[model samples]
Target: MATATRRSATRTGRTTGRRRRWTAALGAVALLAGTAALAGPAHAMAAASAPVDFATHCVPPPIAGIPPIDGTTTAQITVDNAAPKVGDTVTVTYTVTKPAASNPVDLALPADIMTPTGKVALGGAQTGSVTVTGPKKNPPVPGKGSFPPFSMTGTFKVTAPGSITLAPGDYNIHTSYIMELDTPCTVITPPAPVSETVVATDVPGANERSIQLTTASGKPGDPVTVTGAKFAPLADITVAGRAGAAQTADRTTVKADAAGGFSAQLTVNDKATTGIVAYEGAAWSAEKGAGPAAYTVIDDTPAPPNSQKLNSSVKAGTLSMSQAGDTVALSAVDFGAGGASTGDLNTVTVKDFRGGPAGWSLTGKVTDFTGPGGKIDAGRLGWTPACTTKAGSPSTCVAGSAGVVGSAGATLASTPNGAVTGGEFTVGAKVTLNVPAYTAPGAYSGVLTLTLT
Candidate 1:
């Protein structure tokens, strides 16, 4: 007897011809099952007439000498979205190569269309059209080969229904050959069952927003532009200033174009303050909003003219000292007596009027000193002075010894323009006399001139 066995082994082979062998095999099985009743004993008829035992198998176990079909078929599954969110229509696509004809390709997904972890549940899967992608001239019908080495794609859509979130997991596509299990066809070998897994990454809901303005600052009545890239399509944008009041513009409302890009210029109001103004915006149809861009409005009024005024209240009556170190402190009144007074001292009040210059140079020059009898040395009389910008403020002293002013006259003090305030300043002085003990005692006087610039 010659024993024939079917088996599977990787082998390179080509298709020989097309035939209808599967139908004949079915008919032969039907004949055998029917004749069993007549040939068997009456008591065993029902059992004997049972259908012939032909276990369904695909690419059967390898025979002793025969080789398995060659030229492997490869398929890859892709999705429009790597991570699908809830309520998103996820597209699952299959690109297949070297597909066989006369066999139907079956794609099997999880029965419930839910994630393996049971976190996400889709509405259901819907199969879309299958498209042939090869042969520029005329594409072959997918799985009905008229061309060799061709590629085709099948697509399906899954809707992530309402709020059931799909957690992170692998969603697999199971594929197999339906008809090629029993009936073999040339140019078609049932590819071994394979699975392709797609990873889930996001839970569907609200998306984050990013929006901004080109420039933050502008003067009153000037144009400031605003832009947003993530707003809803064709949505209207409303802009406002610090008070949340809608900004006045040539166009108060601007709409975002189809791609969610928006741009519009708004003018700062004339009544705006000289300080900073913050701007913000919102899309009419959006759940979120954007920005507080700071803008500054400046005042542009000119200032007034300045003037400088000087007054002095010195108790300049007489000078008398008992010893070389003896000092006579003169009482001096400032802009007013109660206002400011270096008691028993001399003080000059300096004021800068609206039209006056900012600063001045003061120099004290003394001529030859004279007494009731004859002349005395001018260097014998010296003074120390200090200045104060405000009436009640403390005074800052000039760098000098207590008795240093001489016949030639020295720079007592020099002040910068800003050291004075409220258009006024005050200068206080303390005078000291250095007299030889043996010198004749008599009334003495000297002319002191003050030059102000």
Candidate 2:
């Protein structure tokens, strides 16, 4: 008879494989449970079953005279609800007809001492692993013999409308006595064919709500326009912005119009840090619905030369503009006799989501450069504009001609009146400041205002 200590020693040889098996099984179980909780409401229920036979490789106890075991396991899978709705949890039963490998020792296996855990790989409409655990139900084995086959049950929720394919993966068996014996088995190469496919359909009258931000990035205390659509008509809604543990300074509750839409302004918290703020709107109903939009918070403090500022503005029914910062700083340069100092302006992004043929333009103007030595004419500043449209845009972005941009302002970029469409365009410019021969020697600053229409 093999002593308990000897059996424990033999188990040590497969420790690595056992650890991997349990980790995968537990992770799959957690993923399945989380996904199920997020599903909406289930549709009508149905039932179906399929037979699966697959080859497996099992690592037997490290007995001096035994080798690794290879065998076949056959099982039948039955789905209780084959056509579930988005939020419905479906039950599945797996019945085994044969064990992958038999016990190689003459140890008496007691009743209710054997437990089995199995895994099924999912694909298609959803992707993840589903774990099935069986209760301890083995009959007393008098001596060296085959493990009894048993049935296991598991459940998973359908998260979206599509076809999900289920296939057998791997499994493990544990028998407890003086010490526990774990046998890890892996599916052979060229995995078994898909066991079954279940279709998950959407709930009736489920309309998806959406939210969009006028500008996607801004500084603290900046006001952002939040627009929502496709909500329940006359629904009371609460819109909030959150960035990690911090919440926006402004939160609004409003009533949706007859068309199931609403608009409100949210102010970024004055103490908010730089990060992405997610704006979410929840509609009040028996079954609440929510939509999300994202805004990036940026630092607004002025830095040394070459530092950039971001700014953006959007018209309610037309074009939208976003910049990298609130201020743009050109690199400091020593003024040479009758020479010029130059730097590149930060890029500005303009997006047309209005789906119209009416075109738009961007222009910039600068205040006169003022310092201890007096003032330099704003007309001394000139720029060479450049424009690039995103691939697939219907509009042709025309760069503005290089010229002086005085207080009156100048066109940085524009689109033909008939070429406007839904797309994004970025505009930038190389700025040159003409220095007078006898200019004063103090630092000077000016404000550059950008406008989009």
- The digit string of per-residue lDDT tens for model 1 on 201-296 reads 344454323233333333357775655555567766665443222332323457778986677766656434211121124422223443323233
Lowest-scoring 10 consecutive residues by lDDT in candidate 2? Answer: 24-33
Whose TM-score is greatest here? 2
Instruction: Give candidate 2 misplaced runs (Cα > 4 Å).
Output: 1-48, 63-65, 204-453
Task: Report the C-alpha displacement of residue 268, candidate 2, in angstroms.
Answer: 41
Mind giving the per-residue lDDT tens digits that candidate 2 earns over 357-443?
345667666667665567778888889999999998777799999999888888999885331245789988888777676666655
RMSD of 2: 29.5
Off by over 4 Å in 1: 1-345, 354-357, 391-402, 418-422
